[model samples]
Target: MATIKAIVEKSALAGPRSIKISDEATFSLPAGDVFLPAEAAARVMQAYGQAVNEKVLVGMVFPARDEGGWGAVLSFAKEGYVRDDDAQNWKADDLLHRMRVLQAQSNPVRKSHGVPELDVEGWAQPPTYDTTMHRVMWATISHKQGEPDDDAHRYVNYETVALGRDGHLLLGVASHLAAFNQSKIIADGLLADIDFDNGKHYADFDKTTDHVAEYGLAALVVGVAAKKLGLLAVFLAFVAKFAKIGVALPFAAAAIRRRFKKRVPARPVAAVTTDRQEPR
Candidate 1:
């Protein structure tokens, strides 16, 4: 089992923050103050390819041996705070509601691939890591281009919203479905691992000493970050590639065997002579 360790820098936050993921391999970000699992990073790089730019703040990939793997990404607003207007009615549920609408309207992969609208299975504002974190669990059936109707893939996604003590917005998402029931387990593990520096937790907020966030927690979910980052598109792309492997693995195995056989030359057999005739 591998683990991911993210040491959040004091510069990135008004306070210190850190997180560690168990059973996953971690990778450091080029920008510093951020980290992600190596597998998730690879998937993000593969999905975005050359299009990936500095706009991507932090990305994580969770590759489950089972069917429930997913990817997560976090990006900061230029202002580094949620907008003032949106912060007024800030609530996790509202942000989630707005996100669903945005996905229905603007997700490029869903629009082009004709993936069905996201169905909300459940949601909650759970208290974990000594901070209140909002979690949304949803499901969707995505149709592959040219695939039979029955071949639609069922996907489950769990999105989490939290505000760092320093007023930084953080989003964590884990996607899986019926075939991948352990998504929640993985998501919870991640949430529990978060450790805010002595003065950087939500509980440590000080209006006098600490800077206040311009936007509310709600803005973190509904803001342009999701749109600009293209979270759903990146996630779906990962799923497509994951599914593609299932289909291609057998062919790939066969090709490997063929190549192996071709690479090894046949051993020459030397003639064997019988020496028993002298005894007779």
Candidate 2:
């Protein structure tokens, strides 16, 4: 097992690199952040106490700014073309309620791992979909159960998803409530830079020949995607370098992904280099 430093040393500093995820999608990784290939990323995750036990491919990590620079990458779930014709303008209350239900279902797992039960406090950004971009963006603010309902004690998970002709690309960032705004901006920007190949773009889908995903855009927000893709195992972990939030909680998020691996089947994500250039 390589040390974290060794892994980072060997990884590509993708200040401006184009990443292709198994031909399903591509990322024009913007300036600032290193990109770890699967093996190296797996090593880093193990060092952080998570076993790479999921059937899914090990995901690339562009460590949050404090750890390295900051950027993003997406983990592709080749479920199928997601039908979005009728999926528009979902209510925030409905989505948040679903999130809370998912949280309740997972509290037992958290307790088993010696982590405190967590509650979905509210949204840092309401569930919103961008029709032009073919994307869905939402963020949840959560707190350890039994904690006071205040910002300083909250944790933020900002999520962004880009749909394709195949499955969808999941990109996200986790931070304390204080970092939510900056993190959201970065996530939104990163999502905008990713694209699928010409024949693979969401608009390229052919109803006569292509398959559609079981869940629509809203499931991506409320955790229903967890059942089909089991994306929690591929979650991005953020570190704030001993942030001064008014809580005694640990700096990193609880290993939420580690708990859901048993359910989602595996799919390998092979990063094929299609192009590279300066960050435009």
Index of the highest-lDDT prediction = 2
For candidate 2, write residues 49-112 as lDDT tens digits: 4444333342554542343222333467788988775455556667677777877887776567
The Cα error of candidate 1 at residue 147, in Å, is 8.4
Candidate 1 lands at a TM-score of: 0.49
Residues 1-280, model 1: lDDT tens digits: 0111111111122111343322121222221122343344544444443134344355453332213445555532233322233333344444445655765565455445444334332232211121233222222222223334342343444444444444442444535334333445544444444444455445555656766656554454455433433444456565456444432112333442342233331122221221121110
- TM-score on alpha carbons, each prediction: 0.49, 0.72
lDDT of each: 0.38, 0.56
- Write out the backbone clash pairs for model 2: 55-266
RMSD per candidate (Å) reads: 21.4, 12.3
Q: Report residue 88 deviation for candidate 2 (angstroms).
A: 3.0
Worst 10 residues of 1 by lDDT: 1-10
Task: Per model, state how many residue pairs clash.
Answer: 5, 1
Instruction: Identify the candidate with maximal TM-score.
Output: 2
